[model samples]
Target: MERTARIDTAPADAPLPDGLPDLAHLLDGMPGQSRRQDPQARVAPPAAAAEAAPAAQDRLRPVRPWRLLPTRLLPTPRATPFTFAYAVVLAVTSLVATYADPAVVQALQQGSSTDVAHLVRHPVLVLVGSALWIAGGVLSPYTLGFLLVLTALERRVGGLRAAGVFLCGHVLATLATEVPVGVAVATGQLPDTSLHRLDYGISFGVAAGVGALAGLLTPWLRWPLLAWVALIVGQDLLSSYDPLTSWGHAIALTIGIATWPRLRRAVSRTRH
Candidate 1:
């Protein structure tokens, strides 16, 4: 005969039978119960999430238009020290050229000219001195171009590089144009007086700076600038008022264009 099975009931907090977990222990190990009982049991957010929170907050902050005006008009020393210092020197030289006696100004310009004669006698002195004066003094359009182009370039690639670009165009273009004249003079094809022709100015350097800066600009801006420069230089060439200098401007601009690949790499590295 089969007998009915008998079972014993246990309380909610009672100990378990042999080899089994206690009722209270099983309940306490559940996710919700464990989190409630143990404050340190909470799962932490990911490292990426923690980092993104501040950036999100920053994006929501408002910017003031008025606060940017001063920065746009006058950049900090750290941002454009080379441009500031160079502009100051040019301004002072412009003033001297304007206010000084004609005889003194003529002497200074003659001494500073990067002509074949001065270059032969003191290549270093004249190469540097020639750049100190603007051909048309303070009001020259080249002066404005110099300030704008150089400031923009220096802000991107830095002061040393900007100076190098300017000097590269200045010295190389000067040599390229003047060397031929010197050779012609020596070979008797041109007059000996050609060696002493006045050629002091910052025009070539400004031209090169414009070209280099154009490479760094957006396509819309860059093409217009290049076309404008070409138009101006082309007109000068057609007019033939100073063919040698105009050709130098064209050469210097080409030199700056040749530097585009390197300048792009430099700008990329700076951004990273």
Candidate 2:
């Protein structure tokens, strides 16, 4: 019995551990060794792994449900006829202002002043002209912003109403900003030089149009627009670089928000 026990049991520190199976030896000893898998079967990849990989990828990728994008955001513009005309004027004025000789610049810019004298002396001329004027400087960004915003505006309130918002922003902002200077000039508070300061751009009207159009958007779109516009206005104010420009923007923003009541009615009527 003692001799049999010694033959059956091996020492603990010897080559093979007591309980562990001899897997490598079993594989080598098996028949049809070419077909028998040493690695594939022993360390097979999980069945779930192959299936889960693609599903995991699908879960990670986002899918958009709504198909119609532009048609809804931008239906046909409000004043199709006038919008193009407005664009043409901007293009022409931009060309002439940027490229024309001194004489041409003077001729094109003649009525485009928002100066105190121009507003007071020939309010209609300056107001209307200034709205149409572009410095013909900084073409791409301004033009793109112009096209997107003006087209969106026209789409919302019709051409005529959009025009009204624009004119209101332009004329009102001009008056609001310049009137103080005019008063200061009269009271000898500021030199007449300040009154004649050259201010030429379509930014006031554009800002107003942008504001009014924003009123027409759903909350999702509207909130982002408001945030961006606020950021811009706030930055300009903080910089203290351009008071007149900043004041005009604030007035334009206010005017745009104020038009919400009337514009909402118009939007409701159109929808119905």
Candidate 3:
């Protein structure tokens, strides 16, 4: 027994860890050749690397069920007619005013005392001339185009309803335009020679009417139209600065937007 113990102790420097499993030997071995390797062996993923991946990506990548909607559920186009008619009427009236008699033109252009006196004396002629102008102006290229556009729009929204909307918008615009002119005239800030027949008109107001119609008819387009109206009015106020030209459209648009709900209700009631 003493000789056997002596041999074991003497073999400490020799290779004596061949068959038995040892924790130090296993740890010192390369990972691939380690004795602990098995079918169930797994290395934990690095904590920083695992946390770096996006968790929400899986949820975000899934397709939505409603994305396959059809295109036919949309409103008819409104701009096609509205723009055409307004331009035509505005142009023809401008042309007729230019080519006619100087006195009549002056009477139309400047609402001065002298011009007023001249028109009063030629009331019949003025009325006849205005009538002809309206006829020609309405049929002229500019007015005709607008009429074509408005006519189509009217077809979509019944004539009476369209008229009401247009008229309401016009009234709002007219007030914006007329009130300023009235104030200017009263204050004598503008020269008597500068005022014209079209000064009190509501072109922008009509635009608001058209915008409102487009907005209400096409639900998705409503906010955009409102934004457009706001921008246009704001620019007009800031730049060209005509209260009526700049702010009239805004007022008309507001009225038109308000009227949209009522108009829709009325149309619904009528349909029933």
TM-score of each: 0.75, 0.69, 0.46
Cα lDDT tens digits for candidate 2, 161-253:
877887898889889999988898899999979877778777777788778888889999998998898789888888989888888988888
Pairs clashing within candidate 3 = 81-149, 84-145, 84-146, 85-145, 85-146, 85-147, 88-142, 88-143, 89-143
Off by over 4 Å in 2: 1-79, 136-140
| Per-residue lDDT of candidate 1, residues 79-135 (tens digit) | 889878888888899999899999999999999999999998999999999999999
1 or 3, which is superior by lDDT? 1
Which of the numbered candidates is closest to the native, going by highest lDDT? Answer: 1
Candidate 3 lDDT tens digits, 1-272: 35543223433234436786545453432343333334465665798547644553444466765653221121134433443344455566667666778788655644422122334365334322432233233444424323443454465556566666666665555545555665675589876643443433334445646564664456676667567657866887788655545566667767766666676776677678
Question: TM-score-based ranking, best first?
Answer: 1, 2, 3
Candidate 3 residue 231 Cα shift, in angstroms, is 2.2
Candidate 2's displacement at residue 197, Å, is 0.8
lDDT of 1: 0.86
TM-score: which candidate is best?
1
Ranking by lDDT, best first? 1, 2, 3
How far in Å is the alpha carbon of 40 misplaced in model 2?
64
Clashing residue pairs found in predicted model 2:
78-154, 78-155
